[model samples]
Target: MTTFEILNGAGADGDQLAGSLNDALCTAAPMVERISGMPLPSHVTVRLLDVAASQALSVVHLGLVYGMAAERLDTEEAFDLAGKLAATAGSRFRMFERITWPLQLGKILYGPTGPELVVVPAAHRAARTSTRQQTVVMGHELTHLAQLELWPDMLTAGPRLRIKAKLTGQPTKSLPVIAPLFEGHAQFVHRDLAAELCGVRARRRLPGEAAPTLRYRATDWLGAVPPLSMVRAIYDRGEKFVSAVMDAGGRSLVHGLFTDEGSLPLLPELLKPELWLARHHPVPAHNAHDQ
Candidate 1:
């Protein structure tokens, strides 16, 4: 059994929206578990934030948390970083403004307390709050919940790697491999859940379509290196890798890869999505009801 608490932010409609989102999350949990081969926690907290709150969180996360991590700054240094961020927030407001809208509808964050999913309901108003879209977004965030519970290391790999580099004087490794695996796995689970629950089929990309050019500043931290476009590649390439894995071995194979940390493929192996598909030999489609 699963449960949720909605932290409504400063409005009456937030409660209703949070309730609806809670229902979507409940509906998505079992299917997400089935597809990802990881069980979700019995309880989850969903926070509904309006545009202002959402933008604030993004600024703090991107400017403060990410900046501190990337530079490995000390407390004194953090104040300087905070000052720099505050100074630029005015000019960069337009650039960072998208966080309040559809570009960032939901986020799954884990801290000392536990895991929480934060979403901006106002972000989805442009789409008139389509149930299918909401379901898909919920499913995506829920997959992150599953990852945090099951493979917490994957989510924190960046900071761990950075610390390792600082301590050992070794070169810091970018999340080229890790981010894709995490984001890709979430993307796959999202699509799988959508198919199972909403009868939506996975969208296939045309040749060359998977790697479109994306814009991002060099200084921006997007949970990985090369900022935005590379981050997008992580999703695009990751989905392809996950799809191939699922086609070849079904959910069991995915479960094996996810659970066995040591056996995870390296960057070279991950780069060749075609090889994985060829090796796995596509299996028949799964009947969602069977799970």
Candidate 2:
């Protein structure tokens, strides 16, 4: 099946993905800790799970993705396509190594909270990690770890998205830009650090293979390429767009889009220029994953 179909939920569970998550964590835990600059609370913990555990989490995340797609494409064929996309996403669950920062997406916790990072295996495999790629992911996740370290304070910046969804009977996706401010900032930090630490040269590449958008690759602030979504049209070009933004402002201002929680819509405006003003300033340089 195509990548989109796979995201809808295709493959069987309890297979290589689970084992890999476990293995990658075992091999990576040390480096993750060393490179991650975020402070770890005394009560914080890290875990490596097999397929059963990963599948459980995958079911929840996949369900969310499918439901979102369903709203946009509610016909039988649409639902079928959605399901396939979920399945594809599920099947490839084996191809990622994710870092689950919070128990729920939008919720924040105080110290003595649950494990801060759930590093998945699938991502490790997809990167075909050499020392370089491993460092990149580690840097990416480490940036996330930094965010998690300060998570409690960060939540105040935006409304709790999941809670809003439940109260309004709206899908989390309905918000148009549902990710927490901290999440957006962390994502940008992760991308930036990963490229520097791992020598990724993200400006030259696109975010993913899905679209035909181009992004700018300037100071490589946050190391992010542009949206490969129908947004950018191509990966390389998307990188340039992003690079120009970095050049105009600084990375932190761009990241503040999520953290600032201003009158703007984060996701949809990802391609717009009004927000580019934030980038007009410069983002202070940070070490790889300066948690």
Candidate 3:
């Protein structure tokens, strides 16, 4: 039976998917090093196995959610869909290798916390519609690795805080404040790096890309493609603030922004519109088109 049919039947036998996965891992080895800036640990090996094997370790698995499933998600369709999703998410796929795994059909899986990428026996990263897209996915994952490295304690604290807040009845809302800085930075940097590395820029965001106009004010332009006006507002304002600070005092003021020790706490203040504008001196009121 074809691999797709097998996956659709009983749970996948882990061994069935191993070889293809191994091949993909091998091919992506160089890229993993380049983007991560750290060599893979010699002892850390990648193996492709069925769902059961994946379960042995904490795995970020992909599966189809009912209603989310579309008939066109098979094989090439999966790659295409993933490519499109990566574009919206500002990521790309590298390559797909084969493997055997025990999982029903109609799903995709990967560990959000472990290894850069993974696929079941039925789907592997392959030639995407464009190489630029492949780089987008790969770049985003690399940035995720960078985030983990940069903030090793954040994840550990996240769950504990959530649980503690629940048990004690204290509402903990810090994550929302933290999420935008971290996720937004990652999202921005991933797209920036992907475009730089691949030499391709994505299309601008369209009108519907942003939330309803009532919820967000449109301002600033940073990304070449249309971005959610609010998001663009944040980046543009942030960049302008940072630039003005540097222009006045030079890199010393800017370097402080990158300090990892305790500088993270400053992000919220920096993101504030008033502070951002104050850092750059007053200017005549202007719309995006005027600038």
Q: Give the lDDT of residue 285 in candidate 1.
A: 77
Candidate 1 deviates by what RMSD?
Answer: 9.6
Q: What are the per-residue Cα lDDT tens digits for candidate 3 across 1-291?
A: 001111221135335444443343343334545533433333222333444443332222222211122223334444444434434322111111112121111122333323323323332221111233334443443444444544544333333333344445767653223334443443444455555544544422323333322211111122223433444455454544444554655544433434342443344455563454354344567899978
Model 2 lDDT on a 0 to 1 scale: 0.39
Ranking by TM-score: 1, 2, 3
Q: Is candidate 2 or 3 superior in lDDT?
A: 2
C-alpha RMSD of each candidate structure in angstroms:
9.6, 13.8, 16.4
Give the alpha carbon lDDT tens digit for every residue of 1-291 in model 1.
668777888376575576667767778778787777788888888777887776666555444443444354445544454456544653465464553244565786542245578887765543344455567778888888787776655544554444445455765442236667777888887877767654665532223323212322122335344444565687878888877777777777776666656545556558886555544454467899977
User: lDDT per residue, candidate 2, 90-144, as tens digits?
Assistant: 6655343122211111112221233234433333333333443434443444444
The models' CA-based lDDT, in order, is: 0.63, 0.39, 0.36
Best TM-score among the predictions, by candidate number:
1
Which parts of model 3 are misplaced by more than 4 Å?
1-116, 119-129, 174-176, 203-291
Estimate the overall C-alpha local distance difference test score of candidate 1: 0.63
TM-scores of the models, in the given order?
0.68, 0.42, 0.38
